[model samples]
Target: MSRTTVLPVTRRATIVGAAVVLAVVALSGCAGTSGSAPEARQSPSKSQSSQSSQSSSPSSAERTPAPTKTTDAAAAATDLTFEDGAALSASTLPAFGLEVSALDGWEQTGEDSSVGSREYTKSDGSVATITQQRITDLDPSMGDRAATEQLFTAAGMPAEQLEEQLLPTMTGGTAQFLSIAGHTTDGSWSATVARAFAKPGAALIVKVQTPSQETLRPDLHDILVHAQVVLT
Candidate 1:
């Protein structure tokens, strides 16, 4: 079986009050193409940055072309595999009514009000999402609850067998935190952590899904916590 992959994410805040659960489905939440390195590209970190880039190049067959010298034109760099470590670009999401200043080299999309999500990416590559949807009622399924069920079902687990905890957020509020750790159907080790919060009218959520890393959970939680609520 193919290795379980945590597809990149880029979303906005959107949810209502619903029961929270723990589960993981396919990484289809954000809905978009992921960033891929350009074909036959070299990493600056490994390249000498100077003259002959021999050691950094691929084998002769993979690097060279026919020896015929013909008048050919040059084309612009097609593969965007090279990353220069640029800073994240700041952006404002009018739908979610928030601004993101921490993003470095990330861009935004999904501006339609109905979607109301601000998706971010770096160098045209997806990293994470701040998906937002207008919340009008109390539906736990809209936040962590919904995320847990969907993800758990996707991975085919006992959705009812997970644990839920009250988590603190940077927004000066509390969120229901839920997580699941087990082997995927393919038998690869996996884990998921999701946090959900609510205010006067919005149901907020932040989910960082990948193989088995616990580093970004708190950071994603705080991001939603501190999001300046401008919804009306």
Candidate 2:
């Protein structure tokens, strides 16, 4: 049987293992969660749409014009493919987003429909999963930008200085911050965050079977550097 070992992540690990976790997390969506709920979903519901329309639609007195379709942060993160034997996939989660990228030769496999997680291959020939969810789950107080900052701080990312330098470039959404990994600040053990992303909130997450700070960080940096908003 194909067993997907989706593991969770920690802030401290993100600092030292930034490069490894970044890459692996994307492909595997092994970025952990706090609850039993599934990861983020790509699509919206009819009720949600109707409610949105009603809220956004202008009233007779306030009707200046039709509300132009505006895009959010999640719309900004794009899914891409590369020639460097890296495979990347992205899905929107309302105000948030989820992305994954991996090297070539990693076999693809199907997984159980629970949480809508898809399975993939780990570097050690193990299986992993990808998930989606809201920023709240990652860290309730901080939004996506802040959560990402925490991850970078924990990962000991050198790019952190760049964050202050590129403050204008980063986004702050109500549900964009992502909580990755399922272990403590220390790197001895690993757990998995399931049913991540609270719908009507953020979504899109990756899971990993193992935690490799070396293998995951660089790819994550590359993805964030190259990521752009996809409105469609």
Candidate 3:
């Protein structure tokens, strides 16, 4: 029998073993790469959670509202109205007692008349007011003249004296009278006549305002002539 070559068989077996080792190593490397893929996907989910938290919070400036301003119409709507022949007495008025009669061609327009002050509005848009108080009520140290001036100023008609005269009263007495020229709260030129009456520990003031001295002089004269003042 011919002898077989032992070296050739050995060489073939060695090559086959080397190929199997390389195949095993390649399969292990592929499995490791696939397991690490989930970690990369988890990084994107963490980033999305952080973004959602930042978007939900609001700043202080975005949550607050702006302030609004007041209008003239709103101020006018709050003014109170009065009826004709409304009266005020020492019990209701702060310092003096008086009764106001309804004047022809004028309408009473304010609630203050029921509590010691009277406001009137004429058809031509003229305004007048009669207010009375003790001299001490205006200022503890003020006299009748100074208090009268202060009253004019407080009523939005700061006085510039035009004349001083004697006003005839229904009780057959004379009251001190003053004619004044000034500007109203709306800056329009105004004329006013004021009368001061003496009482027991108090003084009564009757003031009428108009666009001109001639406009309400007759009304002023009539009001002063018939006004009754009780010494109490």
Candidate 4:
């Protein structure tokens, strides 16, 4: 008869326990891999955060807009008014029926001897003369530019540079101011002339003579600015 051989019970149990333990270890390794997969996916979030930070910052090419520039002529046009400036003394020119003023440091001279003209001299040797005449032949339809040219021509003065100025009068009128700058007829000295028309049929002429235009321009401008037209 053939007989079957059997192993010990403890030894069989030990082998089964080892198999179970190996299966648990394999499942633990799989769980660890699954948890680490979420961590790996988080790397994209960090990369996106870095990109977002870079986009929020200002670029190197960005700049603020610059301010506009204000010119002297433009400033004079807007800032100069009838009320504000240096103190002045008023004198009426009876020939033109208009009033004129001289600023401080200017003394009136050549009173009646000039015949419808008044002369003013400053301590610095700057000279200003004011004259008036009935210009019956002056055509008002030709505009101030033409009148200025005609006046300069008649006075034998060259109008190298002609600029229009706006002078406000106390009588609520705006006189047309034509400013001319050039050397005299003989080219001996630089001079500036301002022709102002406060009324029709007459013209008020102011001539300023100096060694150079630079030295005379300020005084000429000031005199023109302070001129008051009082029609009596």
Question: How do all models score by TM-score?
Answer: 0.33, 0.32, 0.41, 0.48
RMSD of candidate 1 to true structure, Å: 19.7
The lowest-lDDT stretch of 10 consecutive residues in candidate 2 is: 80-89
What does candidate 4's lDDT look like per residue over 14-98, in tens digits?
0000001011111111111121111001011335434643675233233222224422222222112212111111121212222
Q: Across residues 1-232, which tens digit of lDDT does each residue of candidate 3 receive?
A: 3221111001010000000101111111111112211100101122543464368423334422322332222112111111100122222211212224324566768635332556667776667655553333433333435544555555544345324433332222223334454334543334444432211123345555556535544545434433333221
Q: Give model 1's clash tally.
A: 31
Clashes of each: 31, 48, 1, 0
Q: How far off is residue 182 in model 1, in Å? A: 8.2
Candidate 2 wrong stretches, greater than 4 Å: 1-103, 133-199, 211-232
Best prediction by TM-score:
4
Q: lDDT (0-100) at residue 190 of candidate 3?
A: 46
How many pairs in model 4 have backbone atoms within 3 A of each other, for residues 3 or more apart or on separate chains, i.e. clashes? 0
Ranking the candidates on TM-score from highest down gives 4, 3, 1, 2
Give a tens-digit lDDT track for model 1, residues 23-70: 443222111211221111111222333222344434434532322331
- Provide the lDDT at 56 for model 1: 45
lDDT by residue for model 2 (127-196), tens = 4444432333444333334444454454543232311111001122112223343333435222222122
User: Judged by lDDT, which candidate is best?
Assistant: 4
